[model samples]
Target chain A: MASLKNIVGGELKGYTELLQDARQEALNRMIDQAKQLGANAVVNVRFSTSSVAQGAAELYVYGTAVRLG
Target chain B: MFDSISIVIFGVLFIVGYLAGTINEKRHYKSIKKREEKLLSLPAISMKRLESSDGITKSELVSESVVVSIDYFKRALAILKVLIGGSVGPYESLIDRARREAVLRMKESAPGAAIIINVRVETSTIGNAANSKGAVGSVEALAYGTAVWK
Candidate 1:
């Protein structure tokens, strides 16, 4: 048996109305990457956001892809 | 001479900021309370399992994010707090409201779901730096969870 580890990220900026879009994009991207690695589910998810510049911020979400039964 | 003038100017500005900030904070808190009452049942709980997954018809993710600006008075107080090594009370309430509002918005997004599980809120301060007077800081709160629709 073997275990693997990797990290991925996404970014977006706009009105508060569209903020969720960015968050989902980041999360979905992480899920997609995990699925590519053939993981069952993601665990220990951690979400982070930071300012890229004035009036704009970027959301970064990550998690450990795992196989659970 | 120049220092005294600058001091007076800042003092007056501080007074104005304090007055406006107090009023704004009060109004915001009032609104938060009202909405919180409406959302009392839709808790953004951290528990991974909200209810029995047995009868769950479907599952999906729900997320909400909000950004709020810190008033000048709070910013000034935060500066003083940095120097005195104390907590910035105003910023704390701002963060509190942001998180609640984010959760409330999440509930709105998942209208079919009654409760969300594994909920978490993340915050970020949008500014030039953690401690900077050059720009007004804005706090962004993001809340997400797994919603089971039955």
Candidate 2:
């Protein structure tokens, strides 16, 4: 079975294309992690972020962590 | 005789100090309340225009508004007035009111339209200690979201 994948821009982008670059990078990381799991697809994915450090930004990518049928 | 004299003096001094402290607290409470009220009355808005997904035809306007930025300084001092607890701290209530008011405004502003996802709440502070301690502090709240009508 083949896996499905999806990604949406993070809120920090705020109508600007520049920050989208960072979001894309985060998404790429998620895609690579999924591929490493030998999964054909990612589904029900979601994104969240927080200021892990006083002046730093942390982006999180979470999904079902599923296996394809 | 000497012991009684010392006791009387100590009692008088303690009473005076207590009275002074109470007066200061009252003044502080008044100032804080005025600041909170000013912030609550301020108007804030978030606006969005929805057109055809392909960027054609007219646009629809949606707005959300509320009093915003109520922090340690802007929240009512009534709670502190009790020297412990009171019926104040409307931070959550303020947010709820703003959301409701904005939805109502949107309903009136644009009828027969479904607002899109991505509703946003933004807060900003105004009059951040503009002058003296007696000055009133203010804040503004805005709501942002998309509107889609077919």
Candidate 3:
């Protein structure tokens, strides 16, 4: 989340399951990204999202990936 | 005859929905108000550094999240917003509710922690369409931080 947005807008989905699946998928992808970057740990993890169309939403996750000795 | 019956059914649903949605929104707002009064006393901040180092012992990651659906009235209001291409008022409140709910949840996650630092909030939209005509406008908010004790 860059800034706390006061506006409330959401996606209209056909199946509720798809919505959750998207979130989970985003999380997995981010973690994998961190791992691939040779990060041993991720700190201060956060997520933000927005929709590109009527039925689709984009979930974004970010954090400080670090290596611990 | 069928048309009349369908009209009556929809009319009843509209009335019930209106009452339920308004009541729920008002109640949630009240709850947010009460919780905020307490959370404000704590030193919640965006920085990773702690304000005080006295008796500091615990550090852990804590998080809280909530999902809220847009009521029919809000959806209708948002539709009008879409037409005008301006700020969406109903969504503002929904997002507010989600954020505050996440904050309260963070407090509960670690009631004993003195302060939460490096806090962040993330939001997403998740609405389930009940029908072709009905728009399910739902949003989810997630807040997370490193909790510390002194």
lDDT of 1 by residue, B5-122 (tens): 9999778766766776677667867877888898777666799775456778877777778766665566777778878887778668878878877888888888777678898888
Recovered native contacts in candidate 2, as a fraction?
Answer: 0.00
lDDT of 2 by residue, B4-31 (tens): 9978865654454345434533454465
> Clashing residue pairs, candidate 1?
none
Chain B TM (all candidates): 0.84, 0.41, 0.84
- C-alpha RMSD values across all candidates: 9.6, 17.2, 6.7
Candidate 1: where are CA atoms >4 Å away? A1-21, A31-45, A50-58, A64-69, B1-12
- Kindly provide the TM-score of model 1 when superposed on the true structure, using C-alpha atoms: 0.74
Candidate 1's DockQ: 0.14
Q: Write the per-residue lDDT of candidate 1 for residues A1-69, one digit (tens) a residue.
A: 000000000011244556667777988899999999999898768788878887577888888899878
Runs of candidate 2 exceeding 4 Å displacement: A1-69, B1-61, B67-88, B129-132
Candidate 3 lDDT over B1-150, as tens digits, reads 999998887576556556766777788888889888977766567897865677889887776677677666566666677888988877788789888887788877887788899888877665343222544456677777889977
**Candidate 1, residue B126: CA error in Å?**
1.3
Between prediction 1 and prediction 2, the one with superior TM-score is 1
CAPRI band of model 3? incorrect
Which scores better on DockQ, 2 or 3?
A: 3
lDDT values for all models: 0.70, 0.41, 0.68
lDDT for each residue of candidate 3 in A1-69, tens digit (9 for 90 to 100): 100011122322223345447756877787799899999788767767677667566777777889889
